[model samples]
Target: RIERLEEEKKTISDDIKDVFAEAKGTGFDTKAMRSIIRLRKKDQAERQEEESILDLYKAALGMV
Candidate 1:
């Protein structure tokens, strides 16, 4: 069962690589795109956490 799962995972990974290669052929840098995606997700999460903290602070001060 585990071996089958591993093979499936590898197949999926290869498919992803092929897709990225196709995108690269269209003049896109997959690495840069991936980096940008990672950074945007991280930034969004950080912004959300910051906003949550700000909301808590405001509520503590009876402002909201």
Candidate 2:
């Protein structure tokens, strides 16, 4: 069962890679897309907290 699940996971990973590759071929920003996907996985409060911290760090670095 574990091996089968691992194989399935590999297949999904490969599919994601292919999608990213296709997006890249079309001149899409895959890294940004990945970040958006990651952010979407978080709840609104979690996202807000992360964004707040990021803004603070940017301000500290004078990037903002």
Candidate 3:
């Protein structure tokens, strides 16, 4: 059972890689797409907190 599940997991991971490749071929920014996917998984409050901290760090580094 565990081996079968692991194989399925590997297949899903490969499919995800293929999707990202296709997006890249279509002229999409895969890195930014990945970041958007990650942010979408978070709750609004969590995203807001993270954005606020990022803004603060950028300001400290004079990148703001």
Candidate 4:
């Protein structure tokens, strides 16, 4: 059962890869898309806090 579940997970992962490939073929940026997806997974407050921290760090390093 565990092995079968692992195979199924791999299949789903492959399907995700195919979808990303198709999106890239259609002129979509998969790297940015992945980042957007990750951000969407976080709540507004959490995202805001992360961004604020990043901004502060960048400013500290004169990267802002």
Candidate 5:
């Protein structure tokens, strides 16, 4: 069962790579898309707090 599940995981991962490749071919920014996906996985308040801290750090470094 464990080995079968591992194979399934690899297949799903490969499928994800294929989809990202297709998106890239269509002019989508896969790196930004990955970041968006990561942010979407977080709760809204958590995401907002992270962004707020990032903005604060950027401003401190004059990156804003």
Candidate 6:
């Protein structure tokens, strides 16, 4: 079962590679785009956590 899952994962991964190749053919930098996407998600999550903490602090101070 594990072997089958691994094979499926490889197949899916290859399909993704093919898609990325096509994207690159269209002049897209897949690697940089992926990095940007990861960074954006990380930054967004951090900002969200910061906002949540600020909200909690305001509530604690009876300002919210």
- The C-alpha TM-scores of every prediction are 0.58, 0.91, 0.94, 0.87, 0.97, 0.58
Clashes of each: 0, 0, 0, 0, 0, 0
Highest TM-score, which number? Answer: 5
Question: Which model is ahead, 2 or 3, in terms of lDDT?
Answer: 3
Error of 3 at 64 (Å): 1.7
Candidate 3 lDDT? 0.99
Sorted on TM-score, best first, the list reads: 5, 3, 2, 4, 1, 6
After superposition, candidate 3 runs with Cα above 4 Å error: none
- In candidate 3, what are the lDDT values of residues 1-64, reduced to their tens digit? 9999999999999999999999999999999999999999999999999999999999999998
Supply candidate 2's per-residue lDDT for 10.
100
lDDT (Cα, tens digit) per residue for candidate 1, span 1-64: 9999999999999998898999899999999988767667777778789779999999999999
What are the lDDT figures for the candidates, one per model?
0.89, 0.98, 0.99, 0.99, 0.99, 0.89
Kindly indicate the candidate among 1 and 3 with the higher lDDT: 3
Worst window of 10 by summed lDDT in candidate 3: 55-64
lDDT of 3 at 64: 83
Error of 3 at 1 (Å): 0.6
Residue 54, candidate 3: Cα error in Å is: 0.7
lDDT of 4 by residue, 1-64 (tens): 9999999999999999999999999999999999999999999999999999999999999996
User: Residue 48 error for model 1, in Å?
Assistant: 7.8
Per-residue CA lDDT of model 6 for 1-64, tens digit only, reads: 9999999999999998998899999999999988766667777778789779989999999998
lDDT of 2 by residue, 30-59 (tens): 999999999999999999999999999999
Cα lDDT of model 6 overall? 0.89
Q: Name the regions of candidate 4 deviating beyond 4 angstroms.
A: none
RMSD in Å for candidate 3, one decimal?
Answer: 0.7
Q: What is the lDDT of residue 35 in candidate 5?
A: 98
> Which tens-of-lDDT digit does each residue in 1-64 have in candidate 5?
9999999999999999999999999999999999999999999999999999999999999998
Q: Cα RMSD to native, each candidate?
A: 8.9, 0.9, 0.7, 1.1, 0.5, 8.9
